[model samples]
Target: MPANLHAILSASSAERWLNCTAAPRYEEQFPETTSEYAEEGRLTHSICELKVLKKFTTAINQRTYTNRLNKLKKDTRYAEEMERTSDIYLEHLTEKAMGYDAPPLVNAEVKVDLTDYIPEGFGTCDCVMIGGDTLDITDYKHGKGVPVSAVNNPQMRLYALGALIKYEPFYGGMIKNVRTTIIQPRAMSEDDRITSETLSVAELKAWGESIKPIAQKAYSGFGEFKSGEHCRFCRGRAQCRARSETYTALEDFKDALLPTPENLAQVEQDGQDGIPTPAVLTNAEIGDLLTRGKSILAWYNDLENYALGAVLKGEDIPGWKAVAGRSNRTFTDQDAALASVIASGYDEALVYERKPKTLTALESLMGKKEFAEKIGAFIIKPPGKPTLAPASDKREPYNTATADFTGVTQEVLF
Candidate 1:
């Protein structure tokens, strides 16, 4: 086995590095750190890979699965939720594989090389299955905060490009189309949980050619700095001068467009009759401001974190200083407190009310197959609330008229 190579323009960071060419080099100054959520994701991915491998290769046994899971469960963040979610991801792959006329060639944790399209670009596809004329690549997302879609997703496209390059020699002309799927088990709704996009080999290759120059420029650290939603996860976002300048421009532009003193006086006088003139903005100005607003808040948050971190480390931040946040009271000894409360003629139920296990926990306890067979019909999933997202996001526009509502209404009596 060989050690995995880290690419300067990794496929996972393609959206960020490709857009902000200076990000890769700038981000290199910061040390890589993983969060508890990231660790949980890694553990879940390991379980998914093992389960898939065991399906094809019998060398892996139940004991191997149990040992790996037992080790993962030792981590404080690990829970039955991970196992349930992993089962959903694995079941999706199995279902997709069964749809093929012939048995599909399934590969898990497959290394993909995208150096052809991006400079040293590479990533591991969670699941890749080839059958007849289709190559399906699936990526697992463990995060529940945001729903991921496969339509026009650069990461999946890059992975597909890499897979095509590696497997083309073996499959040749038999592979006509590539299908990319994103399985986000924690998505709010079932429909949003799975998203797939298909493209012909010619289309995918053309896209690869389109990004070659951008990747090369990023590789040489010679492209202009650009920022957008992609900066959300960029390590150098807080220190990026270009992003700061972009945000500053918004304020400067707004100040320059402020109404004159005479106009303000005229509006005040005109509003004496209870009708005031409304401030009007041109469509172009509105669009520009809207675009800037989307990123300004995120940039401000990043700046706050950076400044606070520096202040906490005893680094001078000019006018800022770290202060202890407000704290809440907690029991000094929970078990002893509970025992004393029970001894004082209080019922145990008053101290602790037992609740039913969550749907995920119950499913994990009873086994997904058995649970579904017995009580799947009781599951009811409500539609998710509409949220504002960038136009580039793949989610469909939410229609307000189609929203479901309960007939019962309560009137507030003030």
Candidate 2:
């Protein structure tokens, strides 16, 4: 669906504004930016809408569907993965509809209103299904990083609320249940890629009530300024004092390591550890710092990028300025350059280097199914390098003891 207008309190960004309260107003100064990934997602979503309309409804004739699909396929960003992923999403919708006794009323890319709760909030639901006492809302995510959960997800919940409001007149308060589903085919595992959670109408309404005050505060732009994981997508994150304070507060944990005058004097003689502070940290300190490690890195990079952009625009910062970095030379015409190199007494082999395509590239070249059918058996996957992660991460704990001896034998070593 083409969205030419957006509400100030859009349902899609509810989580950010709901948490930060001041993000919506603060973000107004920054223009929205798009990336190749976002463009690809929009293309994939268009494909999904077309798929649903063709499969479930009689609105589109075969000829129209074909022509529309053909036009979409011609987009430069279109890839086999888009088709494959959209099919996965369609299959999930089909399975859900089939589980019901009779065909459920389905709507694709339906525009929904949330003005009953939030101030002028409206959004487009990817798919909505109404049957008996239940309403199902499915959101398709094209991201590959974290697998979004349907449980307590504010975006999904808000969409569900908007959906209920959109169909309330027709259902006449008979709809008692709401189910929100997130279909992320690009997630790492099959089991976690698609997830669903059910909520009663009362529960959903209660949640809406809980956020009404916060929504009002956000709309008025007079609420508290707080920072957390939700700050990732906020345009003001780079300069927000609250977010900067959140990371700088970590310095308080280092009070124990503060250097004394005598300790600093010892460092004057030789660069060695001082006497006042212990060289090692306790497990508690490690645990405390580890919690903010990922956020610190992300915040640091965002700040750096912002500073670079500011400097390039001729803004002055004390002791800081942007300068040209190193650049590598490249041939304007690679084929001609290579041909010249070969003709100039250089062997053809010396002028060119050959490398095999990566597995991902090959998979994209030959659609996923064909790639698996042709050479899946020949592929081997090695264990990944160990890295630190939080306890709440979905991946299993790494076992250093087993990993050390799994492929080693004493006889071979001897």
The candidate that achieves the highest TM-score relative to the unseen native structure: 1
Off by over 4 Å in 2: 1-4, 172-174, 188-192, 255-277, 323-385, 399-414
Clashing pairs in 1: none
The C-alpha TM-scores of every prediction are 0.84, 0.78
Residue 24 of model 2: what lDDT?
Answer: 88
The TM-score that candidate 2 achieves is 0.78
lDDT of candidate 2 over 240-352, digit per residue (tens): 98899988887665753546565677677677764445476656557766776778898999899889989999897778889899999998999998898899999988877
In model 1, state the lDDT of residue 24: 83
Alpha-carbon RMSD of each model: 5.3, 6.2
The deviation in Å at residue 380 for candidate 2 is 9.1
User: Which candidate number maximizes lDDT?
Assistant: 2
Candidate 1, 1-414: lDDT as tens digits? 124475778888888877888788778787777888888888888878887887755657889867876887787777777777878888888898889899999989999877778866788999899998999999999988867789888899999998998899999899999999999999876667999999999999999899888888888867778888788898888988988898887546664344545556887877754323347765555666666676788899999999998888889999888889999999999999999999999999988989999887787799878999999987655445777666765557876654444112211211
What are the runs in model 1 whose C-alpha is more than 4 Å off?
Answer: 1-4, 189-191, 251-291, 362-401, 404-414
